[model samples]
Target: MIDAGALTRCRHRVHLDAAFPEQLAAAPEDPGVRQRQDAATAKREGIRRTLTEHAPDRWVQIDREQSARRRAEDTLAACAAGADRIWGAVLPLDRDVGRKAHCEILIRDTDRGGYIPVIVVNHKVTDPGRGAVTSGMFEWEPREDLARKPRGQARDQMRVAQVYRMLEQHGFASPALVAGAIGYGSDVIFVHDLTAILEDYDERFVDRLAIARGESATVPSKIGECRSCPWWPGCEEQLTQTHDVSLVASGSRADLLREAGCRTIDDLAAWDQEPIEDWPHGAFEDAVVTAKAWLAGAPLVRRYSQIRVTRADIEVDVDMESYQEHGAYLWGTLLNADGISVYRPFVSWDPLPTPDEARSFAEFWTWLMAEREAAALSGKTFAAYCYSRAAEDKWLLDSARRFVGTPGIPTEDEIREFIDSPQWVDIYQAVSDQFICPAGKGLKKIAPVAGFRWRDADASGEASMSWYREAVGYDGEPDLSQRERLLQYNEDDVIATKVLREWMSDRAESEIPLATDL
Candidate 1:
């Protein structure tokens, strides 16, 4: 039986196939994947230990070093013996029952005297504002005591539902499912009722589990989950053989066509000829055009008559470098005005936020505004061009807020206006609205299609992040070469944006229809 965690997270049949006994015995362990798994295990253990400390007499700890089957047996024994709190319990449903479910924790309710299944997650449940908690990709509103909420409120409700059913099978009576999220200084627990939802999904769950058990062929539902899945390489080959529409389109669009009996790219391309009733306007046609371009092995770029921006006399291509662990450290700008091109960089070498970083951010902001003023005086419009402007724009605004009251820092209103104005050109959006990229729509993916190449062969945002981390010298002396490499990578990114902008502007003269026009 697969665990509740697996049932919740694994979206593809290939994921289940990889988990089969044969595949597990043959597949090599990835060090990065193992490291992440180990980290999660440690976090869960840490939380369990903390909970035990809080109520030593109530909690009973289960040793996890035992084999999977033995652990499940031990958990059942503990529950049968009426343990008050079963920590790290593993309850697996009967395999002969056709559907398999395994739940982690089974805590006894002090007042009700019944066990409530708990799912532990090693993620922060931050209260951004109000009484809402950040649960996965969405914010959920919970009760005052955080005891219960609507089951459909969160994206990861499958985990709760699976756990609820598993507990019910084991004869544990409970009104709600509990989720324990590790917080900064304490653990925040949220409860939700899933009785009705589980009742509705019982039959569908059995059918899906049957497919996972290899009773039927599994269809690939391509989604964001494919990115980290180890089975993607094999599944991608299968998708290519079948010419699945998901190979080119993703999310709801792919699901919509598949549900409408248009399974493959060819099927989707021919959908327009016999349109589905109440089809979304222009969506089918757009998918068809995109699919045709993918089959032809050509870049699909469309041109719109309503241009977002024209060639400006003064333009600055901007890119920012930041460590996920640390804050923004570098701001690279390629200034081009009236045939002259110059590179300017604002950098902070510190691993942590210091006065130096604050000064660098202030200087970058001051220089940019000065240039904008100069362009205004010269009767020329000034604009900042960036690929995937969200990250760069966020860092700029966040840095300004962090350095508020510091010298050379722009006011909140000034930064807000600049971000809201058309002066900030998001080249990514400009291209995405006009083009359909089957390869990818990322800066690195699309820039090369426009004949823009970085001087450094290994130049990438990920590589730059690694270089920045190494340059900071956590355990050894700082590597200047790494720092230099990161700077060059940032410079290349800005230059690529500039090149892409020019490429798009040149293509604007063509009589190609826009993606939306399709």
Candidate 2:
């Protein structure tokens, strides 16, 4: 059956899953997905408990342990009995349309004389400002008394729409085109106006349905989602053998290049003509450079004659580790000054989403500021480096805001000032500006080229996420060894950034070939 998730998944994946199930390769185990599923289950249970506490006698819960058919039967019986709420309701599969849905909660709308779907998801659904209204924790109907903040979760909306369509088919949908979702770590029910989203949802569902029915082409293109896709190995093999343009260029760039008769890396490398329509000047040139570099098996090539890298007398490489959306639990810093280097880790052993997070973040911020002050006083220039400023800056501002009253936490303005200053160096941006990396520009991709390696062979942000869960005892008893492994992994990350910066400054110009030379 075409479940809600399938509607938003890779279209090629939907086709393969439906039409070529035997050809589907197994994707690597992603512990993060399991972690999120467990967390979502906990949140769903929490929401149900809260609802039960308020209106214990009004709710009917469908047993998830029961068979799907039995659960669907129970759900319809609950509706027939005019139950106020049905938790974990599995709708009967619609064979005609090949659609099925497992709703988190279905609340009976008394005024509309039918049920409305409520989806519980593992991410925030609101932006913390009033733009929408929601139901009371005890009530199902949207409350006029409350003005709640709301944000769009497209996936959640589409899921809700699918359930709504199922309800409509069975004559159980609420007349009002509305639904609600409970987001991660939130009590407020975020409501959605499904009417506005249904048209778009229907269009996507139709397209996916066509693909699943084997009525549409299922050409696989390398994309961000392919990293976790089960068909990746097969698709990568096909793309490599076919010399697909998408191997070197991505998204619209690949489409544009193909339209310009550059269908493969070889084609792109040879075509030195005018820029493709809608391409920014020099972007196509860079794409061609990427093609040539890819064909040459070069991980990276210089974009210009000289590579400029920022350095300081007192330089600090920083990396922060966070547990999902809980909090930044560890701030790993490598301080270098006067020919001496030391690694310092400000970490909270406490489980994330705890008050101790403030302590760890505050300590790191205080130490960093102290070092900056000391450097300035000694007439030494100072700079703090991170691979990418986006991830680090997000948490920096978020931490400052979340733990505002906590000791040692910087003000939002202070954090902003530091990030905006020249003293804050984003090494990733520097690499991107001076080089064209056909492989990628992530620290893990570029660091090895500079001869920097992680202590843990399997060191990766994804693997680190699983490590953090074990270190903090998310699954069961905490494994303290995982904590050390995580520290070493994080330490290696900060050092990788340091080594990358040094290599760009010292060796890149001579070792790397300029794009013009290619």
Candidate 3:
């Protein structure tokens, strides 16, 4: 039988070749199929490849990706014709005579004839980021059905809800199942040693199996009006009944109010909550004030500004640093800035926007976070993306142990308990992704690419992990000075990231404006 190590090596090579044809120039099958499957994996495909953490729900729901993997397997199977049963994650589920499930692999020592591992990392797999909302593809779906319910929770109860049907189609968010497949397939195949598995199997092989899986859910937001959002019709209907905000002239109100110079909602509601905000000379507020507006049943006063982006004259940029928790190193960089760089990730950077988003000592940290409440309706931000993930490891045990001076919980353990809570963002990922990472597209390699030059210092390209490993055994005082050094290193990380972004922007402006459109 083929050893698990060889199987891992073979499968990962297949994933990298199949997923990123352009980057590798290594076709899915030697060279014959280069026409389509191996065509330059476009920016879109590259971005799709970057989404390794995201995966399909089941073994069969995703076909196109399966077909690609199948083609890749055909060639590899040809070379490995010399070996016995091909070890795989998912077992060989019964299939119609010609249909393919997962390639059958043998486990030497399981009760159920050594059950195989199955992983489903299809690019087509969609998730309703941890905020508990479904994708916005259908119109009639309710808010609870689309935004709050898990597909797994409602799947078996399909007729009970629309979201249920989706879950029925996708399946549950599972780690063991996911880890089994990705351990040997696409997730980290190109980045790591999926190909480095052992030749023979033994009980020790279980511990040797290094697999990780988690709910790497992205946030839900509208690419457009609810037309694509599952909760569209429901939210829209609800918005119409309670307040006729249409007269406000915009989705976010400050702009329209600015034109009329009315300034506050009390003035608008006083004018019967009409379009009087558009009235000249603040004439809009005059009408509402004229009608004993206080008692005219206008509306509750809006206590804050409708639009939140403050106009700053200084040149500000965004930078993202990506690193694993507990590890003392830098993983990658994602840099971003206004006016100069394109907002999209994959579309802009060849690898896209990981480190480009991390700018200058992470000064944008304050403003970026400050704008959260108002920026909710805007494009995906660092906060929304980082926080909504599942806690699948003990890596953050130290951070959980640290006392953050916040009001929410009483103890570090409590904060750790809620670390994966959908409402909170992972500060580690957020801080690293925003201020340090250059191309978060690949955490392992981006740090070196950005020139933080950390291989010798941290050794593994992660940050503070050594501290974490050490802390696990004893409660020594934190090496504050080393922490200070690490902080400076992290700050340097953001600075290096910002410099790299400027270089990319300049390069894009001259050589690849189209690429920069990302």
Candidate 4:
């Protein structure tokens, strides 16, 4: 029996193909995966408890429904108490087969004489109001910033429609969707009508389910979704054996190549010698280069033969560690010169904006500006490098704006000019432009390939956040060891960026590409 959750994941063909098999198989335990799952479960239960407390006298818990008939009867009885809340109400899709949906919350409308199903979500709502308007059911999600506008796609309406179908099948009154988002110490609810979306889903998703059921062949797609998938290892091995073109190309490029009769990397690599008939004229050369890079296991494939290097005598690699709730807490910098390396860390012990945090931010900016000025005075070029510039750039801009009157805070104009200047480099963009990453594009994934390793085996952004929480005395007394470990992790990140920069410099100078290069 396909539940609403299972049907939702059916949007991806690869996920759909692996779902049933994975359910029946005994999969190996992944700590990261388990941690995430546990966190989600706890969040859901916490929200459920909160909602239950809000309408304690009115709520009727109906999670114990044994069959579809029993669920329908229980749900109907619960709805009799108009304007009251029903928690864990089971709604039936088919009585004979006993297919049911255990809704998170249901609100009975006295005036409207119907039930409004509320789907509880622990994660941030990517879309808030649109899903209900499109699919006719409400979505509940966390809201970090209430001022930010809700965004969503029309395709997301299908999930709401599925829930609406169950309500209709169970002979329950369907009304507007109510989305409850709990975050930032409050619950934000959004309401919308899903009539049109439900009709569209009936016309579209019903037939797709039939096709999905009959699908015997696995549809392999190399995408971000594959990272946490249980079937990834087996699927990757199969794709590698077949030299699947998806290993080197994805989305429309993969489709175009496959349509042009270049189904695999082997085919694409040989295409340049004898170009395929009706092949895309523009992408032909690039496709061949990418294919060759994949075949040769090259680190990078340069589109242009000539490499552009920014000459600098003084180089600094920067990495920032921050919690979403808190502002940037740690600014790690790795300074490099001829036969000299130094690690500098500017840190804030406070979780939120206090005098200490303000001082830390001020110190970091002052030190950075001083170093840049010193380089200029000495007639040497100074450049600051980071793995991905978005977070670092955003934090700098935000801190400048938030602490405008604070001493040592650079002006917004100065910050913008500095970021836009050639003195600042984003190594991720540089590497991506020059190389085709077959393994993955993350710093942790790519850095190890260049012989850069962290002292801590399990160092990650999530792990650092967890350690920071402990260091800040979230659970108990602040552990100095945890704080030290976090600093070390941040130091390793900056060093990794430095290593990547040096590796790029050497490759550009020698013009000798790595084995993965095209």
Q: What is the C-alpha lDDT of each candidate?
A: 0.68, 0.86, 0.29, 0.67
* Cα deviation of 164, candidate 1, in Å: 4.0
Q: RMSD (Cα, Å) of candidate 3?
A: 21.9
The digit string of per-residue lDDT tens for model 2 on 1-518 reads 69889877888889888986665544455665666677788777877788777777888989889999999999989988889988999999888897889898888988978888988887888765566777666676576423446676778988999999998988899999998888876566778888898999899988998888888987888777777777788889999998898988876677777777788889998887887867842477788888999888888999788888888999999999987788899999999998887999999989978999999999999999999999999999999999988888999999999999887989999999999999999999999888988988889999999999887888888778878888989779999999999999989999999899999999989988988878
| Candidate 3 lDDT over residue span 359-454, tens digit each | 211223234334443344555332222211343223233322332343321344543544444433333343233231211223233334434464
Q: Each prediction's Cα RMSD?
A: 5.5, 2.4, 21.9, 5.5
Worst 10 residues of 4 by lDDT: 133-142
Total backbone clashes of model 4? 9
Q: What order do candidates take by lDDT, descending?
A: 2, 1, 4, 3
Runs with alpha carbons beyond 4 Å of true place in candidate 2: 20-28, 128-135, 140-152, 279-282
Candidate 2 residue pairs that clash: none
For candidate 3, the lDDT comes to: 0.29
What are the per-residue Cα lDDT tens digits for candidate 4 across 235-280? 6888888998877776556777777787899987877565544554
**How many steric overlaps are in each model, in order?**
0, 0, 79, 9
Candidate 1 displacement at residue 228 in angstroms:
3.4
Best by TM-score, which number?
Answer: 2
